[model samples]
Target: MPFRSPYPDVEIPDVTLYDLLFTSLTEEDLERPLTIDGSSGAETSYAELRDQVNAIAGALAARGVGQGDVVALHSPNSPAFVATFHGILRAGGTATTVGAMATGKEIATQLEDSGARLLMTVSPLLDAVREAAALVGLADDKIIVLDGADAFESLTDLIAENRPAPEVSVDPSTDLAVLPYSSGTTGRPKGVMLTHRNLVANVAQAAELLGVRRDDNLLAVLPFYHIYGMTVLLNLAILKRASLVTMPRFDLPEFLRIIQDRRCNFVFIAPPIAVALAKHPLVDEFDLSVVSSVFSGGAPLDGEVGGAVARRLGCSVRQGYGMTEMSPVSQLIPAGRDDIPLASVGVTVPNMECMLQDPATREEIPVPESGVSAPGELCCKGPNVMPGYLNNPEATSLTIDDDGWLHTGDIGTVSAEGVVTLIDRLKELIKYKGYQVAPAELESTLLTHELIADAAVIAGYDTEGEEVPKAFVVLQEGAQLTEQEVMDFVAARVAPYKKVRQVVMIEAIPKSASGKILRKELRGA
Candidate 1:
């Protein structure tokens, strides 16, 4: 068990999305010095930030956005994203934040699917939002910009007037707080409906599991559009009262400089960022003495670089696993648990249930009660589980089974100690000569070898007949490893069916903003 609430649960007040705003404003927070928003062109005290949140939340209520209404936000990491997100949730409407770098097609697809009635965006990306609005038959006026003549100027004005946040009774168990989207395993993006209870429970789980504290300066670079960033960095940070260092885009020089300048104590990272930090030579410029730990999530990290970065920084480096469906957190490695970065994504967090089941049958597989399950589809259940999908009942039925379990599409295993190790993606598994092969397993093996900077594994077919595993590799600069040498390196490790029949040396791996390798895009290539 973790540290108990200093105050009784009933007396402490049930945490809601907007409750933070009010508490931050009315309560004394001399402990938190101030916040520097890198994405926004200004500075703010925690007290001032609370007032802005109240203004925006009240402004949203004035516009008649109420319970169950869909409010979308499309912008980079900025103060607007926070205010708009809090405003939408506090007003009782579901908040959906789309990836800032999403293409017109991806944006339109998610927009039409979510049935969002209103959008908040920056001036730079207005056209794309407009295109998405048109796809869903929404009017141009529904597309609200942050700056210029077409800006949605209502909420900012309300903040200036200091209006009370709209009066509304909210239940943690029932009210919708956020509607983050996830692909689950296949098909297009569908909105995962998360209630206020789901979010609060997750906050408690993360705070206890990760040992988040108020003094930790955090680099919150993960996109708010994704659940991992929104929950772990934004909400969890608020609960712990950590100072968030938000950066809109990823430029290595700038990202590194932010750490050095701000003296960030925590970093929420994805696989690509982990790889970059491990391989980049300029990383030595910064003093990371205060960076107590770095948390990697959303995607799996290479054991090689994970170990390298841990040793290089002389700091705690850990990984987490989750999807939007499970209120976004399934497992996380505890800080300073051990020397080896567990190939597993730590263990399932407190209060959440995770298991491995036969992928085809959906029956639970027997394994150690705690650690990682046997290699199979991973499934979870908890209060944090989403109620259902938005405007898509059929899709919801498919993701969450009749038993109320959120079936994660990834193939994984759990050890006796409850450590969850993900070996493959269910959809990405290749059947070579009727034997099953996990692409990620091969990729991890290849990446663990020295001289290989990054690797991607995908299935391809030969002209004669069979599907085969192919590898795309980016070798470290000045390393003289040949294709044959790389293939031989893998040949020593596993079964014949898993061998890389073909190899392609590439300069980079194609990835999404969330840092997941675009296997579909790789197939097209």
Candidate 2:
């Protein structure tokens, strides 16, 4: 009863992630440009990147980081982040990437749970890294700054001192490569164990699906910490031997300027970026004629907005669907394909099976004979799926069934042609500007405020088509607090992206007999 992929299967390379990237490059390709810094106009060639990865790998092995050891990479997207990430994998260690926006406590939690041996970070984020490292009993010597500084051990110095990269054995299928933390179906963040095979398979699947030519130039505005960027944008670009312009952070003007200056041909963006392109006046200030396509993902893109952008830019606008657990890409609209309908996430990638199922009953739903397919929870099965959640067997079992289908918790329908259309999310996590903002995390933060008696968070959309976290609060008796005060309290503690944007005062949060906050009721109100 499952809908199969429309495209023929692709042969996934049976090699480690490190080998998969390096084995395809010819000697001439090694000298080709790899990563270029958008702000500084600096560039790292493929040859240079490979040398740095080798040196860093040797340095990690010399420092006692070996197979199964987790090295925490806590930095914004930069040339060093690329080197350190690959170096960890090459040295038979797993890299646990932490978002730049993570708070000190959040970083500490991941570090503690991951059991990381080394923390690599830029100098600007060293304060948070130091705080988190202290919480988890990490020694000062173990913290390596990617940017060289007089006070701390530097990643460059370590790599330079170790001339020869140490050799290590890795099992592509069993050895952990990257442990990117994700909030599975529910609860606090947990590490998603992605083996070398998983990463390699996803890269292979996306490569054929996206059809990136070797001469293509990519604009990399998305954060490398996120799975979407880490795989599709960064790793995929490298595998295809495409030139990529890297941004430490996204700035509207800077993003546009790089595309114009670098003559980037393709852009991999989120719905928010696409919205800006359609509506922002500054977009007209730069020449974006070189861009041939704009692919949006991480959150749903309004069909009207996508069509508007396509008309304005005179290029193809498409979307893909996946999550952190599915190596983050199960479906994508292949390039140069105009047959798919607007808002469709295109057909499933090669070697992946997708189907819609009743959310409660778990029965597979058949595609309707006429009109759109029935809406149900989308389930996927593929080799690209993660092994499981780190140390959480219950959540893993609940998310991935015995038959290996990963229940995406997204309510959507699949067309007879295998194209998927997403309608709504069954999960409580709010997708604000493409970032997952968990309601539980916000509710816990809100409870810390003495004035708030009870609180519940739900997602709401603004006029711009971006998700906004709206908090409904029950105040203490005779307590007085303005909406701005409530918003400000959360803003100070959490990252800027996760901060509560709107607040509504309520007498009490509606709850069920089992004491669950009825988020739907609050959302309706």
lDDT (tens digit, per residue) of candidate 1 on 1-525: 111112122222366766743465435563353356754425565666666777777777777777778888887776667766787787778888788877777778777777777877877887787677677776766666654335455345557666677777778788788877774325677788888888877776767668678778888788877888888888888777777888888888888888877778788889888887887787888776667788888788867778778788877888888888777887888666773345778777767676678988867777765654457788888767888888888988888888777777888876765666788788888889889988888998888776888899999889976789989898888887888888999989988878988888888888777778877767766
C-alpha root-mean-square deviation, each candidate: 3.6, 9.9
Candidate 1's error at 330, in angstroms?
1.5
Clashing pairs in 1: 370-418, 371-415, 371-417, 371-418, 371-419, 372-414, 372-415, 373-413, 373-414
Error of 2 at 26 (Å): 0.8
Steric clash count of candidate 1 = 9
Report lDDT per candidate: 0.75, 0.83
- 11-87: candidate 2 lDDT, tens digit per residue: 98888898999767799999888998878878899999988998999888989999999999988888888888999
Local error of candidate 1 at 372, Å? 6.9
